[model samples]
Target chain A: MAEMVFQRTKGLQDRPFHYCPGCTHGIIHRLVAEVLEELGVLDKAIGVAPVGCSVFAYDYFNCDMQEAAHGRAPAVATGIKRVHPDKVVFTYQGDGDLASIGTAEIVHAAMRGEKITTIFVNNAIYGMTGGQMAPTTLVGQKATTSPFGRDKNHAGSPIRMSEMLATLEGPAYIERVTVTTPAHIRKAKKAIRKAFEAQIEGKGFTMIEVLSTCPTNWGMSPVEALRWLEENMIPYYPLGVYKASEEVK
Target chain B: MAKVLMKGNEAIGAAAIKAGCKFFFGYPITPQSELPEYMAREMPKAGATFLQAESEVAAINMVYGAAGAGARVMTSSSSPGISLKQEGISYIAGAELPCVIVNIIRGGPGLGGIQPAQSDYFQATKGGGHGDYKMVVLAPASVQELTDLLMEGFDIADQYRNPVMIIGDGMLGQMMEPVELREPKKRNLPPKDWATTGTGGRGHTNVINSLFIDPAECEKHNLKLKAKFDEMEKNEKKYEIYNCDNPDIIVAAYGTTSRIVKTAIDKCKDEGINVGLIRPISLWPFPYEVFEEYADRAKAFLSVEMSLGQMVEDVKLGVNGKKPVYFYGRTGGMVPVPDDIVAEIKKILGGAK
Candidate 1:
């Protein structure tokens, strides 16, 4: 008999993913849950879901969860991590929840050196709010709100969250990875493990920015979305390690 | 527990510590800055946590996070800063997390003056944010009352699993008074079994949320919240009466204005006029029963406040049109003195505005 492998990760619940058919949030969530399960921190992980497409993450993640208001998940994660310093804490947020309204929250939380992990999914569009223009949307990209292409003169260019956040001295590790291909998905899982490892070692403020594809919001097929992500999103958001603290480095 | 002479802002800090608040998140704002400063200096020494957040929006969300994790937490700010916090407040209220908030109100419609004012009365008692929610609004009339109310405020928050606010003014915050701090009491309270503490070995994920997309679900949530508000109205009505045994006129006021109104009532008594006073301690509960007792017998009602009569609306509603209600107020950080209130009461009784 052939040995069996690749069983379902016990870190996630049996509930089906509620994301759009071709969106990569389900893939990203699987990577995170698999990493926590492999690290033996599944039951001890406290996840904070932001007010965007992944807002119902509490039902999907098989752990204690708290849903935060839009853009406020970092601050909420800070509060939770502060009270239980020994527990593993993470926040799953999208572009609109992190870069636009919660800019202050994410920046200040990073500056304070809060001991927690952040899984930032950048799809470059507001998937939960009817595909509105996001702060991470490419300059030429058209959104529901930006019916015409995004004008850099008026809307500004896409914000490089990992690059910008790495400039702060508080974070222990900061990396931007992609999940467009199988090789990239494996690398993305490795980055997610390193983020949680930093927290396990008591390193402060670790974050991983996963460049994901939103097929429904991007108005592309699954294959087209993956190709577009590699072609368009990767150039603006180059995938690599942006920052690593002295101990982690 | 010595009767030390301390500022009201400092007293509030001591009260919160006595109430077992293990964490504090706040930002600097006028008049109330001293309160956060007090927490910063004292919380660390007590082996607790203090974080000066980037903004009021960040501060309140920080409180939301801490409270969701089952820790007793608090935050403080002034008028403008509190306005910036309404978004987080609505979420915290909707999530049913227990916490304490302090609003050292000043004059305002936009960055109003830093002096004491009761202008935030409506904002505190009525819905300050965009929601159908309520907070147990506690208005303290003195520095001692500030300490007493906060001791009860933290418990009130924990008991109801809701947010409770102590809205004072710049005078109470800046003034110094003798206060004998209450010793810490381990009250018999229910455990926070529903908090998200990483689930432990419970084998069940505890979720803290308020979002319900379906209209029927949202309406059901609204009904559940409304029932809690109704319970608060039943059990939390609080007010104090001064010389109401038999009165021809009643003066309605709270916070700093209540002190001045008390003097005006005394002056009226000396002048052989039957003028009593009603000070609503729980502003949301409104203490309307006090008005029901005197509305039938009193000749009229006078609502005096430091703002342009914000609390007057509640006073009229409490009176329920049984007697003609009069309002005399000063705005823009101006306080009406005892003589001014007495003059207004006399003119009103004399059938004048």
Candidate 2:
């Protein structure tokens, strides 16, 4: 029998995820769990799942998990981290949850310099709700609500959370990364680990925005979706650390 | 460890911090604005989280989020603001999350007034949120009680995995008194094993939610909540009976009004009027039996309140029509003084003769 070499990452259950094929949420989830395993912070960490496509993240992450109201994961993580300062607390939020309803919460948490990490998955469309225009939807991007593509005259400009948050002096780290390909996935993992490390170091407010793919919403095949992210999303949401403490160097 | 003069609202806030509460979310409102203010400055120094939400709705939702994450979270607002929080409160109740909500009640039918009032008696006791739910409501008549109740509220909330309400009025929130801050006992909370802390090989992941789609499942959940409430009513009902021996009249009140009544009863005693007071500490599981015993002997009972006539109904129910239950109150931002209560008690007692 051929030895099974590549399997789903540990800490994530064998159960098939609910994400559509080519959906990058699975990749991001695996990356988070992998980082937690590598850091050996799984038992000492808590994760808040947002109210979006990944609402069932509690089912995927092997660690203690909580489901927050739409857009309120940051607030919840703040609560958890404050109560259990010794434990690592992080929020896994989607574009809709983080950029729209939860805007104030995430912004204030960052502004207050809360000692928590936030994993922001930005696919630029409302996936679970079926392709609605997200706050981060690029200009001229086609979505269900933006059938004519996002009109700059109509819809406001896409929000760059990493850059916006970096402007605040409170955040110890802020970075945007993509998971469209293997090399980018590795970089994304490094950014994610840096965020968790910031928290472990008692640094305040670290967020990593993962530029993701929602093939189902974008109406593209998985491979094509990855290419689309590289060509279109990258220029709009450049992948790099917008802010990090010099001490981390 | 030492006595300090503190406003009731500030004392409650200070007590919560001392009790290890590290998360606070609130929107400013009259009568209770000092609570969030106190937390804002103190939480940071304590290495806690504090946020002034955009609206009362958002504030309570934030509290819901924090509580679900197994934090000792709290929120405070007056009547109108508390009404806005009903939606999130219902969710917190349904999720069985531990939290504390302080209601410094003001007069209200709608934006009623920014004065002290006990009008929210029914709302606090009957669960201010939708669905079948009950919060352990603690009414504090004095600054000491307010501080003690804040600590007790946290304990009760964690013990039952449910939200508890520290129900005070504007008077209690604003009054200043000497209070000895007691050292908080270490909490006996189980490790937030069920919290969203990363599972780390925990047997199974936990979900905190209020949505039960199936009617039967919803019923079962509600019934569980009801059972917890029943157990609380039996085990946690608390009240204070003052000068009940050979009293011809018993006064029923709570919170600041009860304190006023205490003084009025003293005045009544000076005038040879035999009056006593039964102050409900646990306003929801009211001291109904105690009031009944007093009603059994007293010829008349008076409910002196700051609201039009909210708690008087409870007093009537407790009295069970055995005696004449009179109500005298000042509403719409007006607070009835001790003299007003004494006058009413004198009239009721004179009529009984």
Candidate 3:
């Protein structure tokens, strides 16, 4: 007799992941997939994949998907959600896509209270573009573009996107969480589910920022990356509920 | 429908609604601000969605989203705003999504002025966005034509799975004219089986995207796009010939300037100087055949433009050295009157007739 303790979620397509080992994008993707399938909305889900590490997310998500231009996934999700209000629409974007180049789009989507959920992955560095300094890169974090270790005088400070977005009045739910440990991963998945639930109820805009790790760019081994994230990234980006409107609370 | 007096901007909005387009995403810009205002008030009544995007860039991208979901959608902006929308326009073209875009052009090398201009003639016809693509550019000389073009533009966009643009100027947008709005004709458009609506009823998941990372795969997509464009060029060429039976000179023009050229042709007739006009309705599917037909009959070809001779180059290419081509233009939101066009024609003719 054999027991199957782990298997791929039905929300995910039959394809090997392209993410590198220790890359938190794989964990984040699985959490989102599990959430979609558990909500029983996998067939009605349409995800907007950003131009970052998750750009090939369309090949991974079992449901319908759209690949948006650099930093424009929120605007694209807004369009999709407006046209098909019955369907569950969401965007998966990275630090460079959301905090920097796509600042206008995400802000406006939230301000308009668009019925779309956003999965914002803040890994503190540009993952797909080969270790470039991102808008969310920490003050002294080392990156290829920030070889001088991200001078505070020259490059300014890392953006606290979850906190900044929580200040807006439109969001129904907003939270920041990480996935370095079993407990943290459970909290992250719960936050993701709440964000999607807000969309399912046709409440308003919702977002979950996952403080992620870039093992290859951070020059850390898989285990070291997790330790580094726990020691450094967690303190920089505090994990907690930033906003929860009456509908989601 | 009975003819009703409507401003060009409002007429354009109504015309889009009549074309079965429910999703309208646009940002407010001068000369075209009334358009979004009109949609904001009217689209809701028709059970349509009207979104005033944060910027022109966001507006076009929103149009891209709705279009990808198989909803007929549209967006409008002025010159500078349209320039900002180019990136999304290129993506929309690349994905082979059908959507309508309206550009009520105003003066600009950079936010020059907001009165009226045909400066975007080159931008609209020569691919305003990056990459190898084209728009079915329709230049409407009057409010009536503005309304008609929008009604047909959406279908043409869906028919070829390409972006269709209606190019107007501030004059056409601001002026009030009588328009008989077409009945909401239900067109038998192709099923959007590939749209990212959902994978529920469909057996396989659908993907609506423009990302071709591999070079070879990207080229194959480009070739597919080229074939669609080739088909459009073959069947969609549109132009109107006015008083070209026997003439000493032919004036090539479009948009608001074309009407002035027509009035100038009347003035030339009164003076016993035979002049004619070749007004191109479709700017990208340019009617070069009209120029080739009258190439030898006319002594000279004159291009009357609101910008500094942008369309003259296309007129020259059309004439192909058969006749001498000349340009007469007014720049920076200046609208040329009939007398000005007539004067330019006489100068080129040099008392030949």
Chain B vs. true chain B: TM-score for each candidate? 0.97, 0.96, 0.97
- Candidate 3 TM-score versus the reference: 0.98
**Per-residue lDDT of A1-249 in model 2, one digit per residue for the tens?**
999988766667677898998898988999999998889887777788888899888778877776777787776676666667788888899989999988988898898788889999999999998999999999999999999999998998999999999999889999999987789899999999999998899888999999999999899999999999999999999989899877554
Error of 1 at B286 (Å): 0.9
- Model 2 — TM-score against the truth? 0.82
DockQ of all predictions against the true structure, Cα-based: 0.85, 0.36, 0.85
Q: For each candidate, C-alpha RMSD in Å?
A: 1.5, 4.3, 1.4
Clashing pairs in 3: none
CAPRI-style docking class of model 2 based on DockQ:
acceptable
Candidate 1 chain B worst ten-residue window by lDDT: B181-190
Ranking by DockQ: 3, 1, 2
Tell me how far candidate 2 lies from the true structure as C-alpha RMSD in angstroms: 4.3
lDDT per residue, candidate 1, B84-189, as tens digits?
A: 9999899988989899999999999899899988898888888898789999999999898899889888888888888999999999998999998775355556
Query: Candidate 3 on B1-353: residue-level lDDT in tens?
Result: 78999999999999999888999999989989999999999999999999999999999999989999989999999999999999999999998999999999999899899989999888999987899998799998888878878898898899888899999988999999999886535556788888888888788999988889999999999999999999889977889898888988998989888888888888889999899899999999998877987998899999989999898988988999999899898999988999988888877777554
Clashing residue pairs in all predictions, respectively, total 0, 10, 0
lDDT of 1 at A90: 95
